[model samples]
Target: MFATESGGVRRNSLKDFVNVKANGKIAMKLADGDKLVRVRTCTEDDDILLSAHGGKCIRFPVTGVRVFVGRDSKGVRGIKLAKGDEVIAMSVLRHVKVGVEERDEYLAAVNAARRLKGGDYTKRAEDKARDEELAAKLNEEKFVRMAEEEEYLLTIAADGLGKRSSAYEYRIAGRGGQGIANIDLARGKKKTHVAAAFTVLDSDQIVMVSDSGQIIRCSIDKISIVGRSSRGVSIFNTADGEQVVSVSRLRDVNGDDEEGDEAEEVENGGPEAEAAPQGNEEGEEEPPEVDGAGEAEGDKAGGGEEETP
Candidate 1:
């Protein structure tokens, strides 16, 4: 799956580019000012989440897009953007069937338990009592099932504030529509924009880099999980006029594991895995090889580089 900054989405079969040479083949033809924002491997049952710099995100199923017959075509719209908004990140999430009432109940119970565990005493006595009662009514089996299927999303702002939110907070919607608020940008006095948004695991570590060349690495578990629309705590303290430009996840390495995961490939926007070249079969067209001279010329002709996400 390939997504562009202009909300275009394209899904092509892996067999389309068999026997790719040293120079990669053109995956999709982008629009005049559009650039590739994300590329991820996904299944038909998975949901695609697109996040914009304006703190808006839209989640839609992968089945919403049809497989393209050729790689040269520009795909269909994935999310509608506002006047000054552009997509920053894309993530693939598992599709789960959940009811509105069930989700509300689960969230209430979870929040109550979290507050109780943190020893929150700012609420009124009656409110605390109600929260305790709600926490006590949590269904153990249902909580366990929901926890097993839950995914956490980490969203960072350019001003260095960030938070972890449950993926369930983002409800699936139709493609080509303005999305719900991803973070609370209006709560702060200073103007801020979303720097990055992606699904992360508890054991994952993240490295953030600022435009001024400052870098900070922190454990994902240290970030506090909050409501979807709440302003997050500061994860990095940037200097004057500094802003975070990039964020990358570092997976925990397990020495005892028999099967190792593939190394992540860094691209224009973020980390993405390139499709491996497959052997050609009979009657298959061979990919054209690009000489070093032609490759440099081709890049020069491409013109206008993509902005770093």
Candidate 2:
């Protein structure tokens, strides 16, 4: 017999339930991890009851709504969706919490489902093996979830290093009592393979006032924030891929923008400041957020203080 993954197994196994009826008869058996669909309901008691049974439920404005249906996909045999009982997938809710994680999970699940229906299992033994494979695939996805925190802090150690005159300078002006105690990555910040360096401007008062009121600058390179984590500011070498700075190294920087101060913010956390950070508020775009669960081995990787607001 061919291997289950060779397309022969799934197709062979589906011989039993291959012809799933999706008409108004209501014979669908929900999968083990059936997504919780939000629907309009009528009462709190009803909502709780449906949720407890793993059935989708939602309150209608104020009234708690619930739909008593089968645990499987076709729903109950005779029972049907009630008026205002809209079935919306919980996938939407999960996405709002962490789009990346939810997206990854959905992809993994879909791949597994496809593998399940691929082979032609004309025999009982083939069916058993297919089911086992599908179960294993789903079980594996339980571990690859995304995380949530998106802020970080990096230590500013270099002075006037990696300076470029071409692009505009990205300056974070210090605020009142904000004493560069630490560098904040701010939420929605993302880390990428394309690297940049943060430098502190130097002068005669370098050693003395250097601790505060000095302009802290970050040189960005790329324009993408692909696969980042939610840890606070932590620096890494652009070439060797080694982490370098951190938040505790944060110190005071120069004051916030003046009436005529003209430096621009980094665009999309990119090294090249040819353009202003997309939004008005500085690098607060879609910072790579992970809920602290999926810290990648590498290619996952921040900021300094003694800077301005």
Candidate 3:
């Protein structure tokens, strides 16, 4: 995944990395008031979603965008934004093909099972039976296997409200189009808009940074999953005047091998993998500036206010 300040898309090649390391090459040229927000490795088969603060989202196939050789070139427009709107997040989605009708039926059955398992008795017995029938039908369908491997899109608003929507909710479209809604921020309890949207798993953890410089790391499963058009429940409790500006997906650090590797890296003063902070506005803390060789220029890793992303 790659994105720029002016909502442009570009694929930076390994040659670009070699050049940047060798001669400190420019990544992508940005327009006035624009900066490169993110660059991530992704396969051509993956889908990409660019989310804006205005609650608009665009999804396009990664293979559709051409890779440019020039680093200073302004890439093609990823999404058409409304005035005063800007891109906040770009996510690489796993490709999953499921018809809308099958998905809806499968989701209904899954939700019913969840409610039933939760001991919710409000649903009628007939509803449970129908759900079971749908489940049986879905089990025989090819979509069921794809559904098991499906990914979810986590969308959080500035107010800290968010939801886990199935990646399938976002249908892939051609580039530069006004996309569909990723979250329903307008009718929510709080009058807020999207701050970030990215793909996440149930086992994943995320770090959210507030405008007040507050940071919180929490489990992704704790946040409720809702429909594409529904407003999300609050995931972070932000104080008045504070808003979540950046959210990063944390890598899984549960296994003993992973823990040992991380401990070894820390002891050796080696850099650990971390999610790059996004939408870090003016006055917000930032990662230390790195030189052409990818070494921090002035700030140490544990220095005050400056940390690795």
- Per-residue alpha-carbon lDDT of model 2 for 167-224, expressed as tens digits? 0111122111111111122323432211121222221011111222333333222111
lDDT of each candidate versus the true structure: 0.73, 0.22, 0.65
* Best model per TM-score: 1
Error of 2 at 110 (Å): 18
Q: Global CA lDDT of candidate 3, please?
A: 0.65
Query: In candidate 3, what are the lDDT values of residues 1-309, reduced to their tens digit?
Result: 468645677765566667346557667666676766668788877888887766777788887565554566555667766566667777787766667786776677666656556644465788767666755655665756866778888888777888998776777777766667777766434456677777777877777888788888787888987787688898889997677877777665685234211110000111111212222111223333232222223524333222111
Q: In model 3, where do residues sit more than 4 Å from their true spots?
A: 187-190, 213-215, 255-309
User: What are the root-mean-square deviations of the candidates from the true structure over C-alphas?
Assistant: 11.5, 28.6, 12.2
Model 3 Cα RMSD, 1 decimal: 12.2
Worst lDDT window (10 residues) for model 1?
274-283
Per-residue C-alpha lDDT of model 1 across residues 64-126, encoded as one tens digit per residue: 665655677666677766665778888999997888788878888889989888775785788
- Worst 10-residue lDDT window for candidate 2 reads 1-10
Query: TM-score for all predictions?
Result: 0.79, 0.14, 0.75
Candidate with best lDDT: 1
Q: Give the higher-lDDT candidate: 2 or 3.
A: 3
Ranking by TM-score: 1, 3, 2
The residue pairs that clash in candidate 3, if any, are none
Q: Candidate 2: global Cα-lDDT? A: 0.22
